[model samples]
Target: MRQRGREGLREQRPVATMEAAEGRLSSEDSGEMGGGMAAAAVEGIMERIQSDDEECRVQAAKEIRRLTKTSPKHRRQLEGTVVPLVSMLRSSNPEFTEAAMLALLNLAVKDERNKIKIVDAGAVEPLIGFLRSTNSNLQEHATAALLTLTASSINKPIVSAAGAIPLLVKILRDGNLQAKVDAVMALYNLSTLPEDINTILAAKPIPPLVNLLKICKKSSKIAEKCTALVELLLGHDEGRMALTSEEGGVLSVVEVLEEGSPLSREHAIGALLTMCESDHCRYREVILNEGVMPGLLELTVQGTPKSQSKARSLLQLLRKSSYSGSELQAETLENILTNIVAQIDGDDCVGKAKKMLADMVQVSMEQSLRHLQKRAFATPTKQSRTKRQ
Candidate 1:
């Protein structure tokens, strides 16, 4: 009787287990079916987008905007839809134009190929037109779209040639907050091309850029790009003069050096270095007045390798200028250097710090000699010119 009871329990177990397993399989099948249905829906939308019916095209563009906003897979699969979307950018209706631009921006987010394709489809000229649009939303979207498209190195020249820089500078001066931020980033991207630097400078971007940097967070991405662009701009005399002329411009860069991220601090220091190097007598006092010592000292120990090197160099420059033939000033600089080296090498490594200081002095002396030699050779005295004659 006990053996028969055991056999009866085993016979009932399979029936319940089989039903549970079948239920899981049915759910998985439904999930796959749902995915298939979604793909089919996207296909239908693409068909509508390509058709000659204006209403269908408008609805389809809206749907593409929604679908591609958060779906990387859809963006990849919809590459062929780029030309149609670019065509919609020329629509007279504001809503249609915005929807198409937003969709194109979304599609270009992470896909490099889509960015190039969109630019190749002649989307740039219309986008430039939208940059001057009376509708704020369209202008913002146009700036953002150019920001995305110019991120591709191949599209930089194409967008630049379409007369986008002047309009971008205009946006920097007059557009809303978001548009200003996007315009700066787009300009930064274009500035990567060696040839576009002058073109950007010609737009008189410094005052607006300085204002933007002054208002934004020091550690934010916008600040990083702003400083980076400012650094690039410093390569030209017009850019350098523009920055110095802008109110609070030098102070803004000094603030970044003190409180910004590592990359930003690097850029900030670079901008300062550029100014001081360009015309040391003119800018040395200008930079020192901004109270840049604390940030420069901190960066000596805490910054990236390139930044640390720059910090040391800038500190040397500032130190040399700060000396007024007074023992008090000399002692203060000595104490500052001692503190930096101690922080770098610790109390136990005093010998190492001494060696490092010696090396720095040696390097500075070598640099001074080179500068004197350059001045000697670059300009000829009366005797040398007479000899040449």
Candidate 2:
């Protein structure tokens, strides 16, 4: 009986050796063991992220979120994680898909480099897809993430090129109000670049931007951003024309100047001033008779040195316009000149006023000389014709 048991043990040992040889066991080698362990860990994460099991997906997402905050290397891990996570955005279960998307949005905030990587890895399509979701929360987070990504100077042009602007603009008009606000804010930042701006403004984007300003007058954040965008739009000639167009162009601006918030007032004034500079001769009567004079005058007294300077500049613009010097009451001219002289009185802002005043004087002198030349060149009447008669 002892001999039979020994034979059985020897046969079992051979079977174990065959199994080890077939599996290619290498645990005895330290380098191979370490590499195998690392590979297995990565495979495990990939499987969990891809798993249909809700628990597996949630745990993987949570772990990735944690890793994103760990270190730069882990942030780079986001580059890999985003690909699978983006796919998960299409999941049938709203909870699982939303969990995946939030994780992706979290990864996007890690850094600019990570943002570029995510963008390069095709994050735009997924994000735009999420915009169609019925979930307002998803829209908010996705829009916020898109805003951050678009905020990067390097990524801005890329974002524009990826065809996100039109979609973003849609969100501004139709999405949840918060999403609309966020989208407009992003559009403002994105519009600073010529490539992005010219495309949207060429499509007549100013009217909508103007409407937004009217709607958000009481919201400081919205007002500030809206003012900045108005300023930028005012930088272009087409934009000025759009604002002061027959559709209450300059008319809309006048209302803002009258009733808008201080920030809105400042920007509205600045935009009007810029437009006045464009065609002051043509728009002079329109400005003065419309009650812009008092606003311009008050600005000089109550504004910052910068705003005071801007007010003075606006007056200078008005002065350049064809005022009926022959018809303008002397008192009006005197009042304007007096306000200008007062501004030049301030040590801080005087330099700017002095420069402007000198330029005006030079222009006046040139006009006067031309007038004198024309008078001197007048032809003599024919006195001989009367003698012949």
Q: What C-alpha lDDT values do all the predictions have? A: 0.72, 0.58
Clashing pairs in 2: 243-249, 244-249, 244-250, 245-249
Give the 10-residue window scoring lowest on summed lDDT in candidate 2. 1-10
Best by TM-score: 1
lDDT of 1 by residue, 318-377 (tens): 655533331122233346656866767777655654444443332233334343344335
Off by over 4 Å in 1: 1-42, 51-53, 326-344, 348-389
Clashing pairs in 1: none
TM-score of each: 0.76, 0.61
lDDT of each residue in 15-36, candidate 2, tens digit only? 1221121111111212211112
- Misplaced by over 4 Å in model 2 are 1-47, 58-80, 90-97, 132-139, 246-266, 282-295, 319-389
